[model samples]
Target: MKKTGLTIAAALAGALLGSPALAQKTVLTVGMQSTDAGVLDPHLNSGTPGKAMLQWMFNGLVRIKPGELSPEFMEPDLAESWTSSTDSKEWTFKLRQGVQCHHGYGEFTSEDAVYSLARAASKETSAFSSDYAAFDKVEAPDKYTVKITLKQAIPSLLGIVMNYHGGNMVCKKAAEELGKEGFAKKPVGTGPFMFQEYVPQQYAKLVANPNYFRGKPKLTEILYRFIPSDSSRDLAFQSGEIDMMLGRQEQAWVDRMNALPGVKVVAMGPAEMSMLHLNMSQPPLDNLKVRQAIAYAVDRNAIWQFRGKNISRPAVSVVPSGYLGTDEKAPLYPFDLAKSKALLAEAGFPNGVTIKAINTTLPSMLSFTEATQALLKRAGITLEIQPVEHATFHQQIRQDLSQVVHFQAARFPIADVYLSQFFHSRAIVKTPTAVTNFSHCKVADAEIDAARSETDKAKQLALWKTAQEKIIKEVCAIPVNEMMQLWAYKDSLDLGYDLKASLNLGPPVLETTRFTK
Candidate 1:
């Protein structure tokens, strides 16, 4: 009797362990390269890591189709349907009824949409206010309808309104009640995840939203860990402490991670174009010959090789290659050390030129800047790099503290957006309407303005090409290589969709994501 009872007990224990409920994974931990988020408010935060966290906690009226990067694949999210005027100056969006906000924040309505749009367009609130400069007004006609009037028709109204940058919506009532500071710390939105807690320089904890519009998420919770160090983050992922991590943008790192058992490395687009913007307002760079010399010193092919062919490609124009209206034939300065030296001599710098820059300490950015430094040294140009924390680097550079600014960014995949932000006079840094014109480049302003309202597709493309030609001729900025997004995850984790590209610049963890084991 004792032997039989023991045998039954052992069998029961094994059965309990093998049950479906006990075998499923309930939590997922993601490691990102950031010390901590400056804020959680969708309209205010601009850091890549902050954007990744916001993706889980918020939803825009329209969103890029999951696992896709282009605006052409955008589909309705909070808004059920939308219509625009023939001129494309006016747009009306119909909000989905019965969509509930996280944490009992009440249902989403047109009021929230209007409030969020106005907030994002305000320079006092959003970092991307320039993107909405064409907006005349945003109003709610009814409880479920939102109307927007633009001063001028853009290439795609949906590009600015989709779930990216300033487009992510927030709970109107929650924002009003919590105020700016409180709401940033504890945001309320309508998505699969809800903010639970945030520890500075540590981690952010989010819980599954049971009242999610689509459905309850399979995972019980998500812990977004802040592991800035590459080696530490990689070790955590290898030790099974983190389910996913942002991988280094190097071929060696990708090869090493891919070889690991049960580890999957993802390299996808659309890539960020890394460009070196010489501040023309600054003394040394103000000289045209000096600017041209710096351009001749950079080797685009060398940079692309350093980051591997799978993850990077040489940039062909001022605007990223693959963007709409980009002219592949746009003139580029070839890498000629002798030409660089001659130009420096003609500029009255017979010995060498020393250019100062405030650069980011982030491994990915620092590595690129250091490589440029080595290349410039060979051409008798000294690149003085002062490395600071990532956040500080962005702050100081925008304040016009850097003589040379190496900015890497992926915009709305449109020539107008890139040209206007980087070369138009209105966006010159330190000015009231400044966006990111670090070079203080105004040569392409005419072509950029013409292209914005051009109704004809061919005419618009021609205008954009002219703008690129002007920017390149003046040597306003040297186009470097484009670096694709890279990340690694465990093979057992099912992301529920093909991992192609994400505008959020990180892996998308949806409600359907789960562990197969």
Candidate 2:
């Protein structure tokens, strides 16, 4: 259901790669693997690195400038202030004056905000449109204030706003002028960096927004290089060709980087979760007993050892360990091969069943799939892992091509957003209105919906707890690992904020980042 907005001409424009800087200007170059920048339209998703890089060029009305110690805090961004109705159905925003878009896109106004939200709330352009399902209408009282009325009171309304959490707040005038193809090539936003040049599969360059509302960025330029090979990225870092990088996931790689002088290896916690989802519509796995067998068969400690204990821990909740409703010690189905085989026999598959799964060929992902294949073999299950290119894997999974889809993703703040996006019947795949419910498991619909409606924080979390417990009790999915992320950088720069963890898995390089030398 994803669309590519890049025109042939725009793609050709992106093909002409640029050389790295010859001088030591105030610039930071980040290296990564894979070059699918998605649509580059904020309305559409541009994978993880694209969104992290976009943070330099875009702002929501309010933003999460997470603290060095406490990242959950929210702060004001484009919208200086606002108020909500007593019932939280009607909300109003007071826009800040003197903010400018990157291009000659004219000063941003309520009209732009109105257009952005309506587009984000529509499924034609957005994957998380259901996240904004509560919005009834958006109205602009004047140039400085915008009001949004909700269809129903949503407990996580603040999390749904298009402007917060590194999501996009696009300008209407710029988008219409360029059209989708042109806009994808040359996006205009109100952030510290502006689009300078883009060369697909090679590099994207951004220059500081001089007239930024928050003041000009300290780093004059950001140069992003696409180095798809893991060994190539490490060699680039070691040879002083790149400034920073998100390194490989195994601990041996982290230890190697740590041994090098002037290289900083940071492990950022409360990060992404890696889960093995069972396609309930698929054969054999459709039986609850068979699904439970897969859960009981997993030895989480073995996975921790294979992946690295320093980077991961056994996951107990569909929610991450630090969050509410998470229990690390007493998972409903703890590791027990005997129980796994027992369930398999009860389901009439005593000799076990053959299951086919697919995943991207990223080293970390393939590593987990290999480990799973080995362990499941001991439990009398045959697993065939089909390796596909990153883009094809994402596309094929939605088509229900695999019974097991193992995916890794960054964290979301609210439990309701995570559960609903992955579990709700309305979010199930293959339907015309499909979202992210890949498993097609539907035991906790009542609780998931109730959690969204509950206004009280404590009460709302209890509902989410019930829903998470159901995922385990019924063996809908197996929570393989929940772990922090590791990234390495040359010791020549000072990243102003804490990189302990980011909403997006990349480092927070912004106005505060600059070279120490």
Q: Residues 239-330, candidate 2: write the lDDT tens digits.
A: 88888987788889989999999999988854677888899998888998888888888888889888888887877687667654344443
Tens-digit per-residue lDDT, 231-331, candidate 1: 99999999999999888889899999999999888997779888999998887899999999998999988998987887899999999988899998789
Off by over 4 Å in 1: 1-15, 18-22
- The lDDT for every candidate, in the order shown, is 0.89, 0.77
Q: Pick the candidate with the highest TM-score.
A: 1
Q: Candidate 2 local accuracy as lDDT? A: 0.77
